[model samples]
Target: MLDNGNVVWDHSEPRRGANDGTSYLCHGHLARLREIVATTPKAVAWMREQLEPVKGDFEKTAPMKASSKLPISAAAVDAADETLGLLCSWAEYTAESIGQPAPDMSNTWKVLASADSTDGALRVQGMRSDGIATVDSVARWMLERIDVIATHEWVEDFTSELCDQRATNLARWPYEERPKPAKGIECPDCGHTTLVVFTPAFAPKYSTEPLLRNGKPVEVTETVNVYDRVINPGGSVSRSSRLVKRTKRYADGSPVLATVQRLNYAPPLLVQCRSSTCRAVVRESDWARMILQAG
Candidate 1:
């Protein structure tokens, strides 16, 4: 168990086999435990590196001769405390997984709590050296366990099994869901031109009355002439003319009609009000499509 009350795996003993009154090794469980153990050394190294500069800063700012209290930055203290807390949690988790007793980590917790309690208190001393030593001791204890776990006969096999299991699990996981696209438009309530609305693809389609221009529905007409050759015993040519009608645009430039030019569908979108004081997300509704398309 780690000093933080985390139970670590005991590599010295052989595990019991299932329902046979025999002892055998479970490589899978050991592999998982080993993977966790492997990270401790790196974590300890990182904690040392992080604390070095903080320790230096404290030493420079702390009183040299007397036992006078020195002020430390809350940010620095919080950072150290967070690192320690993570280590503690890691230790506790490791211990719990292996069904072993965890160590008493009350001292480490006190160190973390002291940072908050010292705030607004009188005569708060900076125990930088003590904090560093405590971290160092914890790191050393973790290293010892790492050494023991590394000495297992199947450590290499455990590592390989862990890697395979991880790959298998990752392969089985589903891909992330894509986000809906955002549609921008003018807000009705705030009159903000930059209001954006999110339209989800699964949302039901909506209909709105066709927009008008000069109190009339906008339309367009096209005229085309086709020439045809006719050999009536003398080789002559005849021409014909025709007119085609298609909706183009309103006088205000809004599209009068939209054609299904492509079969591919677009993702849903979100639109938000861009007004600084009235930043609101437009709700998904039938009217939202009109606002998006019209704008």
Candidate 2:
């Protein structure tokens, strides 16, 4: 558990007796890259707009003051220009990687990379020099665009690819004895037969409630319950549960009818092999077939 009360999986500890083979792309890594790819172009455009007025001020012989002082300083203008250039280069790189024609960013990348070392400082100067209202608008626009990209449907393709790669690699491991949920299985790295088990503690369930705008029911939203049970080799068990809510809204900001919940149980849990020297984890279905020969 984190200090913020969020439960996070700690994968930092190296697995005992694990293979020191070539590294592979995992789901988390791919998702992060996708976010950067999707948001860079939008961020670049937004930063350019915010810096346009400042650039105009810089070009003038006398710094143009808005109300009391100059709208933007020379340093702030330089920093914004550098940031925009870097973002343009990133956008072009991502476009090419996704099979799209790269944007013309030769001039953008030609700019020196050392113009601004701190993005936060540039933003602060921008906000202080140019009114706070303009800075807030740009900040909100950038955040909304990033949020849309983070939750976009295209992420599923990246996740599927990661899962497929993992399955293929795990298939190459040689097991001493077949794994089973009932009798347990031996660790692939170590010869230990003891393993920690994990199973669904509760059947999945959901409930819907009508959302109201004013006095009328606009739409229905559904909340689902997910539960998991983790059992150690010593028979000690722990459970975790969470409630997830799904909502939909129309373009006018009115709630829409609820959509059917799509339950995803990918990369199903595997028992944690309890060998101090070799803690190998295998897929639940694979272990069951290996031990019970269950179809």
Cα lDDT for residue 147, candidate 2:
25
Model 1, 240-271: lDDT tens digits are: 55555544657897654422233222222334
Worst 10 residues of 1 by lDDT: 16-25
Q: List the candidate 2 regions with Cα displacement exceeding 4 Å.
A: 1-25, 37-69, 91-100, 104-295
Computed on alpha carbons, the lDDT of every model, listed in order, comes to 0.42, 0.39
Q: Which regions of candidate 1 are displaced past 4 Å?
A: 1-70, 111-133, 147-295
| Per-residue C-alpha lDDT of model 2 across residues 188-251, encoded as one tens digit per residue | 5575666655432223334455554676665666688878898978999998889988665678
Model 2 CA lDDT for position 233: 84
